[model samples]
Target: MDNIDKMVGIRIKTRRKELNLTQKDVYAATGISNGNLSEIERGNVLPSSKALVSLSKLLQTSIDWILTGEASIIDNNSPEISNIEYGLKLNESEELIIFMLRSLPLEEQLDVKNYLRAKVAKYEKSELSSTSNHGKNVMDGNSEIA
Candidate 1:
């Protein structure tokens, strides 16, 4: 890999470690594949835009940091999507799911989203049901309820 690639790779690996993420974790969330991720982290291969976008979101950093190492963090509360970075470890299923979701149209994606939301809602409901099964109440308290 070239110097820029090497530098980017180092930054990705460093941030991932800082977050205590394993390669499996990242793979699960980003769907870049463990082997491809390893190469990118090693600076042996340049990452694609899709990969970069997914990585940024998962790493909670920024695309700028991964590519040019300019910015450090992404504004999570911003109205628009920031170039956040994410590269902690991920599992294979999670990675593929993330990858598949990223590739979907907004409308179609809603189905998968609802499915996931139901899963979370079910989990939350089950957990709190013992006390008070207020499903909406539980989701309301989550900052990331969406």
Candidate 2:
């Protein structure tokens, strides 16, 4: 199975067990067929974004959490959706954050995340006037740090 499939399956299993839910219960709430969900939970299939959203809500989680086993965490596949079982769109900043995250080692990812959080907090709190500058410094045609 593909890595994305594994991710999906792992997330599904994690959530299902966390809530003491059965595959049938998920089917009842998410409208995903039992066979499909079973395959997905076994890493035999990848779920679409719609399916991911359904599972997320049923599991009381976010799409990112369902897809990558991490909530509010960025990774290489965050923007791709190449193996997502559903179709959905990500905002530009979200996309950029994911892309940027891809360049860091897994161990360093949390550090980068902390930096990003600090940046946002600094700007939001007006603790750093420079943080209010335009995105020209960090934005490219496709990726912007703003």
Candidate 3:
């Protein structure tokens, strides 16, 4: 494979690992065989357009990004999010969430966003406290041992 093909393959492999997906999972989702995926990851062969499209959809990325390492800009005025039913294959629950979010009023959607933000803040605060406490305990334990 050439440099561009190797770069694309690296992007594919990196994105797959980021999603914590195995080759088997990718194969099941994209109908691409495990051997093919392995070869693609190793930069031995370029993937077809169909496979690239399937991977971009499954990985929630753009084909341009996968192929050229350039991030595609999403137009705010465009109905890009709503047009997800085109080639993207989302699970039922994911589809339902998008539907429900789209169905909500602007105010309700803002409220949902605020609620999620607050929940994330609380979780992060708790995690930080736990980590600090663990560090303190380790320090104290070392002092006692010494």
Collision pairs in model 3: none
Stretches off by above 4 angstroms in model 1 are 75-146
For model 2, residues 1-146, the per-residue Cα lDDT tens digits are 89888888987888688667777777766689889988998998888879986776567567787776668422335565522534667778877776777565433655786788999997777744555444444464444544
* Between candidates 2 and 3, the lDDT winner: 3
Model 2 clash pairs are 47-85, 48-85, 48-86, 49-85, 49-86
As for model 3, its CA RMSD to the true structure in angstroms is: 15.9
lDDT of 1 by residue, 90-121 (tens): 55666666667756643455578789999999
Provide TM-scores for the models: 0.55, 0.47, 0.54
lDDT by candidate, in order shown: 0.75, 0.71, 0.77
- What are the runs in model 2 whose C-alpha is more than 4 Å off? 72-146
Better of 1 and 3 by lDDT: 3
Clashes of each: 24, 5, 0
Deviation (Å) of 75 in candidate 2: 23
